[model samples]
Target: MADKEMRAVYAETLTELASKDDRIVVLEADLMRATGTGPFKEKYPDRAVNVGVAEANMLSIAGGMSTEGYIPFAATFGCFATRRAFDQFFLSCAYAGLNVKLVGTDPGVSAAFNGGTHMPFEDLGLVRMVPGIDIVEPSDPVSLKALVQQIAARPNSAYIRLHRKALSPLYPETATFEVGKAKVLRSGTGVTLAALGGLMVHNAVTAAELLAADGISAEVIDVLSLKPLDAETILASARKTGLVISIENHQAHNGLGSAVAELFAEAADRPARLVRMGIQDQFGEVGTEAWLLEKFGLRAEDIAAAVKKALKG
Candidate 1:
């Protein structure tokens, strides 16, 4: 598995897709370099549009572009993409059923030194509220490229949260993915570890290995498709394991934890005990990714401990 930046893969993949599909267009809110869409802009200069720092305007413009039968991808910082452009996202894109793809970079702790204002801890929560919108957080470069292609080929509003920097590859180069599915990386019968986006998937895999050393079999599920989540996979794992733990970089309230809880809550016949591991209702702060993961109790060891505790109680 090679390590590569997801943003760079996203740009390269989008550029490739645009070459074949003339309707594909890229839009940025003056953050092409930060979001790694510069390659797409450079390759297809006429197909790229930078709308300054106005995220709302960028989304609105994407909605208008979608009406013209163009698939537009609007990119910006996660915080600005969702928090600053809720109106445009909900009304202009989702409500109107426009084919727009919203790319949010540096989600959660990936913002690093950008501090709380730039880090988005609740972007998923905000986007989840918009009716008829697809939400995705790719776990690796392969998944990012695959998901970007999927979003571009579809005709619905979608929000894709991803890190701008390089990430450890979670899948092979030929690994393909779908928009509303969860990939089970590891299988177990004791407990199920469900993780979404960023480093959390990597942590969950590590935690599963640690749990195995302790004679605890844990299933690991990479939840790339956030909206219209793969309930079949989640439910099957929960039923087999009888216990579940969700890990994510976002707040535990309305992110992966909440999504899994909602799925389990409705499953009266196959209910499983679920414990969540994530930011404890706190805001992000300035720090390196490693420091922030420790500060927020999102380390692989922390997830292993949570699984141990969940098994006992």
Candidate 2:
């Protein structure tokens, strides 16, 4: 866990980006320590502002800064960012199309011990509904760093959701990321597993093990960008594999699962036996990360089961 941590990678990459870009400013709602932005504040005290516990005020201030030719990366917990200050985000950032990066940490069951109040299972869905807002959830450290660099350089209103705990590295350091495209990690003719965030690598491992046992190879696609979904990649994979399974930490409705389904439906093709594996439209409960994942059927075993079921049906 310590060897491959996404939080540390995010902090380090953000610090590097801040150093390179003079216009980059960071605003946090009393979550600099939790979101690993302390180093940025220490290095660039004048650029980083801690806005106490007011999420709405932080968003408005970030919007105001962006209006003045500044790129503000507002950081806070996922629940606070989406549920607490959604109106501010909509009016100040999305409506105005300001170049503000909304960083939501501790998304989904990643909040773990922080209880249900802190868990943001529907943040992605909520943010995705906002017009002109780009939504992303990187799968690993490498992808996270690349995304941070891209977001820093791009002038757009975007929201990035990160897990509280660290994640294992799934992609190579040289891997290039496109804003609206998905990455195909494995090629197979049996099943296609499309995943986002930390669950992408987990499902890939499960697909590998399942392949060895059942001789049913699974194609794994890492969907880093959620808003502008790579319809071409998704349709191609479904056509090739004949079975599709979507995995994510968020809910099945209005998230990755729903997005994929809508794409397949509009294409009007017999894509595959599609299956959605996620929180099944339920609220998260208080527990450890591992326990919550298992309870919500987001584990590798659960994913493998879904794939098998999809293949058979």
Candidate 3:
């Protein structure tokens, strides 16, 4: 199990990265504690910035900082990160080709009690439409640390869909991760269970095990990089399994599921069947994470059932 909470890993990783590169700066919409960047702020008081509750102003500040050769990682709630500051991020950062790491913490149901207004079910779709923005959702502490360092080192704009809580370690301490690639955790032939985010990927693996008990083979792929969907890896799995089901902690319309759909759509004569399991285009509600996941049919058992239903077709 990962001993450190994800926010600790995030802050520790940023502190490590900043120690070597003076260009790395931390920006928050007065969410240093919420996003776990308080340690980073403490370590480098001059380097960490707080823009109060103004997410848009934070992005604009980050954009300006990017122009001055400073790499800024702006952190805020997912809802405010996308819908609240969409234009500033789209134009001030991405459009201007600035290198700002915009961190959207507590994506989807991870917002839990924060409720619908705080939940960002369409964050990926918004960032996906941006021309050259990089998207990554790390599933565990190991991957989160590795990806955050990689994201901070990049010279182009990127969005880090962060889930700020602790979970059992999903990858080995020696695991190597790369941007724009999906990591395969299990292999099977009956169907492909594709997922991203911490909760979804962990459930996908459990769902695979459940499928195996029923004499069905399920392959699990962690679609960590939402943008640049790893077509090579996912396509091969879909081709072998002949069915694909993508699960996410987001809206079914335009998140990872939609990305896979577009990929399959472009593949032409490739594998055909796809089942997207997620929030059915509804507003997020105030609930426990478990309740929200079950309410939206995103639990491991739900995933297993969806696989069975799709296979029956």
Cα lDDT of model 1 by residue, 1-313, tens digit = 5788777898898889988999999998888888778878788899999988789999999999999999998988889889999899889999998988998888899898988888899999999988888899999888888888887877789999977788888888888899999999998999999999969999999999999999999999999999989999999999999998988889999988998888988886856888988888998999998999999999899999998887887
Which candidate number has the best TM-score? 3
Whole-model lDDT per candidate: 0.89, 0.84, 0.91
Quote the lDDT for 113 in model 3.
Answer: 94
Q: What is the model-wide C-alpha lDDT for candidate 3?
A: 0.91
Q: After superposition, which runs of candidate 3 have C-alpha atoms over 4 Å from their true positions?
A: 1-3
Look at candidate 3 and tell me the lDDT of residue 302: 98
Clashing pairs in 2: none
TM-score of each: 0.98, 0.96, 0.98
Q: Give the total clashing residue pairs for model 3.
A: 0
lDDT of 2 by residue, 1-313 (tens): 2346666787788788878888988899888888888888889999999999999999999999999999998989999999899999988998987988999888788888888888888888888899877788888877888888887888788999876566777777788887787888878878888988875556566665776587878788888889888889999999988788888888888889999989888887788767888788788889988899889988877777777776666
Give the TM-score (vs. native) of candidate 2.
0.96
Give me candidate 3's TM-score against the actual structure. 0.98
Residue range with the least summed lDDT across 10 consecutive positions in model 1: 264-273
- lDDT per residue for candidate 3 within 1-313, as digits (tens), equals 4456888899999999999999999999888889989888898999999989899999999999999999999999989999999999999999999998999999899899999889889998888889888999999899999999888878899999999988678889999988998899898989999998999999999999999999999999999999778999999999999999999988997888898998899987867589998889899999999999988899999999999988887
